[model samples]
Target: MGTTARETDRERHDEVPVLEAFTRFLGLQRGLSPHTVRAYVTDVGQLLEHLGGDEDADPLARLDLTTLRAWLADQRRRGMSRATLARRTAAVRTFCTWAHRSGHLAQDVGARLRSPRPNRHLPTVLAVDDAAQLLAVAQDRAGDDDPVHLRDWAALELLYATGVRISELVGVDVPDLDAGERTVRVTGKGDKDRVVPFGVPARRALEAWLERGRPALAGPASARALFLGARGGRVDPRTIRGVVHRLTAVAGVPDLAPHGLRHSAATHLLAGGSDLRTVQEVLGHSSLATTQRYTHVTPERLLAAYTQAHPRA
Candidate 1:
């Protein structure tokens, strides 16, 4: 159950003034988005509450490296995922650093606080043949003049071709595409814009959707959107997710989400000898580290390749 205002007040009453001030600093000074700021505040709130368990403790003054480590250990005991624990560690460290700099504490206790490295799980990706089969199924269903069928085919094709995120996919507008150049301009995280390329299959799918599919569903709410729902409005990510799930179900493959399509795209690109820097640009990743995670090949695959080709073996 969520805390009531009274419960929250009692839980955080001792640290309310400092927490409120830090939230303002995050918003006004650091310019963090409301969602991000809320996450940081919530993480910090948990830390503060943990420290406030002692009735007369000065939570701010007691914010030490020991307290920060204890908070992370407590989170681990709660069966939280390693990623969540890593984020909580970062949040608390950032909060403590800022508080110390602002004179809330005599020393920067978080300066030595280390966030745990998050576990890296290889993303679930479709093999090339599987991706081909998935798209083939969508295309088969799109053989008729149904706008819904056409949209599904194009959405899948574009997803696998460009490796764009779901938000970037659904946010595409008609003018975002350049048919002649076969590129789509996308706005990604951090409000960064880049144009990513697609292939002939995607081009054909996109053309068919725009010329036949989109127009049929184009209501006033569509507002120049590249993809439209049955109700003639811009397609929601939820609807796109349903389309992906339906496509995978029809293909008789493992349940694949939109992100799986993106993972497949990036993995295939790496397999095709695309350089990491080029792939990073294509995916609009601000950090190359993120792109590496999405496309890291297995050691087993490397060993298999060596055994097949090495003359000494």
Candidate 2:
């Protein structure tokens, strides 16, 4: 269903040279990773596709507030998620601003383009007791069990214990873990690296699996990845997701995933009176505003506390 090179060439009439040049500029000047660059390119591609393929149409010249608004409306009609719409809006705005600065366009059409405000949905997290139960199950599975089962158990335990992303969890290498310091170095989004500490439970599970489980499964040609597939290459995020989903289902929790564990960790930390800044650092959130949302308490909890102490009540 993907477009072929011939199909793309056949469809392009007005070739906007500036767009390609700008994309290359973003790659070279911004040092954005390949994955990030691809996303930005895709965002801009949607705009170009909207403009149609008329060679004489001059896509950049046709761009205006009306055109931009129409594009956004069409996206909404297509049922794009708010987060996705926001990201695409940012991409178009940035591209237009850059084009004007570089003298490619006389006016920045995207200047007035406002991104849709994303809905503020509170993330769901497990209760502390449920999190404990999940970890206990992981620990139980890690002891002298099947090698594959033990590795999966350790992987899930670390996720619940540290609340790291599935990508970050799989990105962890063997050398990055400093057992003496009780910290593991993780590379998060935008290739940012941080050291996150795990508790005794996670540490013990990891130690047992690393010492026993990994060796049994790792063949002589196995790679040095911290987590491995059956063939001994690095574990993929999908694999991690599947493992967590199945294990959480066995615990009788529906709709739990690796990210829910992350939310649970942050929520529990805030509820336990851990400082907001510390939780932000643990989660590697880029903005404090993002970290602050986890601190919101429900009215029911507040009313329960008030009822216990109010003299009039």
Candidate 3:
């Protein structure tokens, strides 16, 4: 005789309207990406479903610290990771704050809600030799003058050279590149743009793609896209991932995705004496703490320097 969570969601009075408003706030006011906005909305929607309040009552009004904790506990019981729980907790907190500001809730109930810190895992990175081999294999493949092969070669080069996320890489426009300066402007999370510099090899590969490869594949729909798909549309993240995975295997290196190339680039930069702040700017990380993860990947290099420089050693 109890109302199911789905039934309660269907009968709610303000849930739909509140979620719609929250979605708009996240996208328009917060300037979050569509993917991020969808995630926050999905998390809050699940929370609303879990609340299962009276049909006439505003569910947000009933959202308090205790209710938020219970929802997170239920999520934990369902085997969600700490990272997922943390993100959900953040979503609820943001929603509660927004609802309070909009006069829907009496107060910000989730203001005190705490997110569980995610477990830190060192990301997989290829050795310098392996990365060289990967690019060498790609360069060899591009020798045939095939457009797709040339594009893949350039993609891998830019990915490792600049350490950009796949989304940023794909979103790059032809006009964004300043070839003379060897810098490309990438729009990162929250649509924030930063200029990242590439080395001579990346610049050369990119020039090849632009001069020889792109013209062969460019079509009316290609517009200003720097990288085009086989069908002449803007390159997507999935295709870039497949290209990395395929080329990584061909190079006889560790199996990895585009993100792995990002990790390798960051690690190599640190090993090559690049400072944390510089890498932070290069990777467009909002926090230096985010860039600090790469430092952990260079323990052997750290030990060598310590052994050589420290008099106490």
Candidate 4:
């Protein structure tokens, strides 16, 4: 009895060993976040499934520019977004390079693969007055001294004050704060650490949370966590996002997630005369190019600068 073509294909495309090795490389060597490692592994798994091997050949050995293009085309046909396509292209290239270096393939076939540029849209940011109004609303809500309200208020304040990602913010521990200096030490992407300063308002909010709020919610599971869920475990990112959305709706401002607060902070910092390099450091962005996106100035500011500096204006 002969095997069916589908069974043969499945046998030739065994991805377990390759995926496990690549997972280790991505996590241990590349130091990618768990989420990122999962994404890369998923992309590579899809690629291998798309290009099954011959009877005696390794599946990855079949990887080539033509097959890579065909895979991307199939993804496009399935209505994948441009951003997803670009990320998958990058994943395949990285995987091929690793495969070659690890002796799984003769060469990095995906080295020549190119990704379509993803659309670049400016992030949503609040106006200065709107931000102040939003904070004021949050402050008013926290006046009741409710533990959850205090935590939410402090979280919002710290988010805008430091422009840290929601993940970084939730990952904060009690010891990460330098109360005297009004700074918080955050772990950013790729596990890089940086210290960012907060304003007096944020400091007051944090103090209230630490002194009055956290104690009320502390439990055996709380440990050193800076924020706690209703059940006293470390706060989740989705919870923080919910807090932002609910507060924004009550504040009558633009409905914003936590990242919107970050965008607003970065924009306000640039508008307030902070240098790009300083903003880059404050935000813990690995590249100055990422920080440069916040440099877009309002027409009023541009005109003011032109009028102030232009000789003929």
Instruction: Select the stronger candidate by lDDT from 1 and 3.
Output: 3
Clash pairs (backbone) in predicted model 1: none
Off by over 4 Å in 1: 1-42, 45-62, 98-108, 298-313
On residues 1-313, what C-alpha lDDT tens digit does candidate 2 reach at each position? Answer: 9998666665554345766877787778766545667788888877877776555455777788898888888888999989788888888888888889898679998998999987767656788787777767666666557777888888877887777888888888889887778898998766678999888877877787788777776765455678877777777788888887777767766557788888888877766657778988999888989888754654665576578779886
lDDT of 3 by residue, 1-313 (tens): 9998767757656478889999999999999988789999999998988776566666666778987898798879989999899888889899989999999888999999989988776667899999999999999999999999999999999999999989899999999999899999999999899999999999999999999999999999898999999999899889999998888888899999888899889889988878889889998888999888554546777887888999997
lDDT of 4 by residue, 61-136 (tens): 6778998999899889999999899999999999999999999888888899999887776667899998998889
Candidate 4: stretches off by over 4 Å = 1-13, 52-57, 310-313
Q: Give the Å error, residue 38, model 1.
A: 5.7
What is residue 168's positional error in candidate 3, in angstroms?
Answer: 0.7
Ten residues in a row with the worst lDDT in model 4?
A: 52-61
Q: lDDT of each structure? A: 0.85, 0.78, 0.89, 0.89
Query: What's the lDDT of the predicted structure labeled candidate 2?
Result: 0.78
> What TM-score should be assigned to candidate 2?
0.82
Residue 34 shift from truth in candidate 1, angstroms: 7.3
